[model samples]
Target chain A: MELSNIEKLLEKYFEGETTISEEEKLKVYFTGEDVSPDLEKYKPLFEYFSQESTVAPTRNITLKKNRKSWYYSIGIAASIALAVGLFFTKTAPEPNHDLGTYDDPEIALEETKKILNMVSQYMNEGKEGLVYLKEFENTKNKFIK
Target chain B: MKEGAFITLTNTFKDKLFRLAKRLLVSNEEAEDATQEILLKLWRNKSKMGEYKNVEAFAMTMTKNYCYDKLKAKETGNLKIVHSNYQDDKPSLQRQLEAKDSLDWVGKIMNSLPEQQRAIIQLRDIEQYTNPEIADMLGLNETTVRVALSRGRKKIREELLKKHNYGVV
Candidate 1:
């Protein structure tokens, strides 16, 4: 009520001695339309606190936008990685070598020579059979005569 | 605890937890994230919440710790201050006309205070917490709480007076 008492309370308040109810009283007293000139300097501090009590914090638009972008960026990055992996995996072909290169050319030529020799032997055997047939026919004719 | 009790804790403490996080982190987005994190933590530790004698205070303490950890991470990483996207419904023309003066500057000034001092003021003045309760929440001695609050108020007063060029009796 008295200015000195109010001053003491203010001092106690600064010292964190005032209870919630006392602080509320101070808020009420200081917030009056007719604040004394002597206490005018402290008015802003109390006003700040009072105003702060009601001041809704500004919404963090950037953070929310960032979060959305973060998810999108991650999705894009994952897709790009997956596409690169698929391209590399699907487009590449397995290496093949010709087996003919591993064979000896001399060995192949010798095998061809052996096959030709076997064909000549078979021709000679056919000629010999024809000769034996002609000799048997002459012997039969002589015996019949 | 009972199902109803968990729901009651959330209902009762959501705004208070949000306010505390907002004050400590000075960003609505961070506060919301911090609130959700705190709530999740509470849900995970619901049994512990039930065991506490003062659930409100415990929840407040949890919120403060979570916000403080966020602040520390931001500082260590040198993260930029990110803005929030949450929209507020516009007030009516009459309400806007009747609105008080802008306190944004005041909030900035309060935010300029050291983390510990700012937290102490938030708990003591804004949250209407007693010194002992605040000390318990902050893991500081009650004397430290008083000192921080006193010093914080003095700094706030000095800053406000310097800006306004007025002397208190």
Candidate 2:
């Protein structure tokens, strides 16, 4: 191909007007050993594109493996965290007593007074029953005499 | 999509994703990291991936977005820069090996370009994507894509020429 034609193609290329096949043509032309001197400067650009198409660093397989392992590590860490949270939440005991109310002196005093009142009531009832039992015993003795 | 379908999509596009990231980030380590993160995100949103007409395009778009976010995060000090030390000087390397030097230069130039231009060059030049496809990926009008690509190419050519006296030489 004429150098001028090649230059025109290059112009089109820079204008983003070349088709894939034309681009490939430019690559093959620039990559040839006998590239024209006038085209030498643009040589690097075409050569760069051609090389980049095939010469990119291969996907680092080791990196991929490391990533797989890293993911596994993250998965394990997340699982452990979730398990610990579940264990703590599931096993922790519920507080049944309302200690907050008893923390007030007046409430505690009222509770104490209620307990004392119940005790007095039971004691009075017991004393009355004893008195009735004593009366019954005296009446029975008089009848026997 | 089903899990298996999504896995298939990921498996299918992983290399492309890596390539795109590598092109964008200019570091293999960063590219790998970006690819993994992108894949994980795709996997997480695999169910919604099916909503797109083209899964590969969707994957590419997602990869680009993720790379942009990573770039921003790196700028904000939320991410660390991981360098790759792989040299092209291996003895057994082919004549195509010299091509890598050119690519390195291209990568540097692309990195120096504005974000939109760099993306246009990546999709149109490096990835060989059609203008329409690039438009879809970038959500720009096809004419806009064409204009951006032209401008990007002209800029790169200008740089290459200024550096090496491209055609005048």
Largest TM-score belongs to which candidate?
2
- Candidate 2 per-residue lDDT, tens place, B138-164, comes to 788999988888888888888666556
Candidate 1 lDDT over residue span A11-47, tens digit each: 9998878888998888887877777788876776667
Clashing pairs for predicted structure model 1, backbone only: A59-B84, A60-B83, A60-B84, A60-B85, A61-B83, A61-B84, A61-B85, A62-B83
TM-score of each: 0.62, 0.63
DockQ metric for all predictions: 0.16, 0.26
lDDT of 2 by residue, A35-99 (tens): 99878877777777766666444554332344566889999999999999999998899878866
Query: Interface RMSD for each candidate model?
Result: 4.6, 2.9
lDDT of 1 by residue, B86-160 (tens): 655654454343323325545666788998999888877776778899999888999999999999988887766
C-alpha positional error of residue B65 in candidate 2 after TM-score superposition, expressed in Å: 0.7
Single out the weakest 10-residue window by summed lDDT for candidate 2 chain A.
Answer: A55-64
The regions of model 2 sitting more than 4 angstroms off are: A55-145, B1-12, B78-103, B166-169
DockQ winner among the candidates?
A: 2
